[model samples]
Target: MADFDVKPSVIDRVRDRPRRLQRLAVLIVILGMGLALLYPLLRDRHGAPIEVRDVPRLPPENLAVIPLAASPTDDPRRVALGRRLFFDARLSPLGRSCGNCHVPASYGTLRAARSPGLGDQLDEFNVPTVLNAALSPYLGWKGKITSLADQLHRVINNPRHMGSNWAWVIETLSADSDYRSRFSALYADGITRSSITDAILAFERSLVTPGAPFDRYLRGEFGALTSEQIAGYELFKDYGCIACHQGRNLGGNLIIRFGILEDPFKDGFFDAATPKSKRFLKLRVPSLRNVAKTGPYLHDGSVETLEEVVRLMARYQLGREMPEEDVRRIVAFLHSLTAPLPENFR
Candidate 1:
């Protein structure tokens, strides 16, 4: 018989190696070849490190949640300029600034169910908080906008929102000596739409709120969360709420159908009279970073309390009936996710 000829590819050879040696080889390759090859293996879909824990029957290697982190720093001057612009109502024809809706004290969102826009028009959806918003891959209830700059532009141009345009904004800002000086110092383009959006985006990105109790627990602080909160976390994962609400921002990274097992809107929690009620079946999951404060909850802001929302999610999304005590514990766990106010939040 002729000599059998066989040759393995590099990947096959590497896979055939001893497990420890294979990992070592992978590490070597990852270091030399860049992170793209190894990143997917080590991280989740959201690019957060995949963790393992010895919890109930759930797969140890499949833990979905990760601790939140502050966004990368932008140029201080740019951030400052953005911050100034964020609060300056002069950008709007109606003198309604971004800060008017995203109030700092209210967790970077409004206290009302819906925010008022340029005139008497009310926003169709609840205002998602700007705190830790940088961690979210997408913005708004629909997850239609992918970048902060784009969202800002939409809000500025939308008649229901800022009701203004770049021409008007540029003219208004250019007339101000202070804005001119600030623009001259930071940007070569000087007060164009892109520059304005960049400045505001920088300020918005800097609104990260870290040091939540849940984050502390994730960092090996065993005592950071109370016993009930701990139990609630277990329930949160076991009940499958962690499916859509995972990653650093917990929920903002995903947009899933509002009801998986049942129709949430049909359960009487939704108001038919609300504007665009038919358009909300599929929506982005809002981040629960400060859920304790960012209410009333849900896309339409129809659900008022965390406990009620929890029960509704369990029944609608998970198709499970949760006891009131379990709901309380889950709400307690959510409370641990609230971080302290950011510096200079006012």
Candidate 2:
């Protein structure tokens, strides 16, 4: 065998090699620790355990119903035009329409604690009811929107909601011959973004809950509701929920943070798995009208059943425990809030 010897390369003797490896190892450890700290911050906030007894049974008078807005019947043509635009799916760039989230006949599908967005991803907050929405002084869970017209424009342009800008919306609506003719007939400005918003608002303003058993009861028909439902109504009032929820709409007058009296955030009730922000705990108290049809209760859609919602309110809001039977009765009363859909919307 020939004698062959090899010498080490100059690069192998560099002083920075050990130091670089050590830095890389330290970086890896720090990154791992950071992620470990963030795991709980990214978790869901809806699965907190609730104590049922905390909520008080408010008086029936305190649980005022939400009142419906006046219809635009004075201008039948504009209202008719608006209704057509509202149902048109062409309003969205992605081909999804408002009705996709706010189902007209279904207690407003958007009324759920958190409606699914374009591709089934959950929305950040619960969808408020369109029923009597026009009567509300403010809109959204945070009461960010001030007027129906303004809210219409915001939703139409919001990337998460309608996913289109004003120009695109106007252009899309103008392209439809029916919309063009209606716009020309209704407004002097023809098919513009403002007109589109006005039309949609007109239609939304007309979404009123028809006479329900509860409404009939309110009208002095004592037999409109069953004994069990009446018992639930009593329980609803006996609870102190009336303090914040009282109004023609049963809610919407004031803003309150969830878990205020009791620590709702302690058990991860408000964004339990997500990073803590003051916004997560603040929400508009929703109207109880037609609540039976709207399921997956609460802002995060954590409570699957109305019974669970009642129990949670008792524990978290009322600061007391309620029997399962009482919760069931309360749910029964809630069912009486359902009313028939408007003829035009159907």
Candidate 3:
């Protein structure tokens, strides 16, 4: 072979191979770490990092809130006291707190279709979310309860529900030093039946979820929702869902018969063992605000998913079966109604 002198530049490049490799490794590691850090955010329910800067500056016209139930006493002291009492599981006969059935992360409703209470007795009806409770006139499926206090009182007294009575709940709270202090700050008379229930009611009234994509859309930020979601909204209005599910809280303001077309009680919505009555009896239409999270839909919570809920609603309420595509679009629209509760709630 002929003798050849390799260029100094080529020799230096060959010698620096390790340094280049190190730099390449460092770049790869940095990218991997960045992906690892971003993975959790990728799992966010919104599917994207919230862009607060891109939010609309002006509220949409024709957007109005329909107050269904009156807000609990706005006294900061009272509201604060109520907030504590709400999560106090000690008041229940069992260890389960108010947050048990109505979970804050689940938009104030538990994941279960029917909540098990006190031990053997399960809540026969699906537990409704306490969120936006203030926007409804009546509480419960029958729509008989008039106020939050009344709702609290009913829950506490129901052996199958709270599984605790007024006397036990009051005495239990009174014995707790923390509760005693909280009650004292809010009530002059201490933790009585009225005070205990009042505190819980006040806290529940504040469980409202706001800032949903639909709310933003209604507020003139038309960009808040995806085209699929907006299509669902149109189907919602066109299909007459807006008749009962209109207003800010959407459906919380009205009481409507479940089976306007066919009696769902035939499916045993209310204990099939019981003799069927007129299926036209009204139920307090639940708020759709958090329906996406507050699943196992309807009063009985028989339907497990929102799509099934939509199917049932169409067949039973509208007397027609919706197209699968329509169901999907409407379900997407319903998801737009889901908003996070303000901070310090959960």
Best by lDDT: 1
lDDT of each: 0.84, 0.73, 0.76
Model 1 global lDDT (CA atoms, 0 to 1): 0.84
lDDT of candidate model 3 versus the reference: 0.76
* Alpha-carbon runs more than 4 Å astray in model 2: 1-74, 110-113, 117-120, 268-271
How many clashing pairs per prediction, in order?
0, 29, 1
Global CA lDDT computed for model 2: 0.73
Q: What 10-residue stretch in candidate 2 is worst by lDDT?
A: 46-55
User: lDDT tens digits, residues 1-346, model 1?
Assistant: 2333334455577678789987888899878777777676766755442333334444322247777677678998999999999999999898888888888888888888887854677777888888878767778998988988788889899887788888999999999999999998999989999999899988888888779999999989979999999999999989989988887778787778888888765656577554555634778888888889899888777778999899989988899999999999999999999888877577
lDDT of 3 by residue, 1-346 (tens): 2334457668788777888787898999999999899888777745443544333432321133332333344666677777777777877776667777777787788777787865776666788888888767778877888888777877877777777888888888878898788778767998898887676666666666667888788768899999999999889988988777766678666677778988877766556664456446678878788788888787767788899889888988998889999999999998988777746476
lDDT of 2 at 120: 69
Alpha carbon lDDT at 63, candidate 2: 43
List all candidate RMSDs to the true structure: 14.4, 20.0, 22.9
Would you estimate the TM-scores of all the predictions?
0.80, 0.76, 0.74
Off by over 4 Å in 1: 1-63, 273-280
Give me candidate 2's TM-score against the actual structure.
0.76
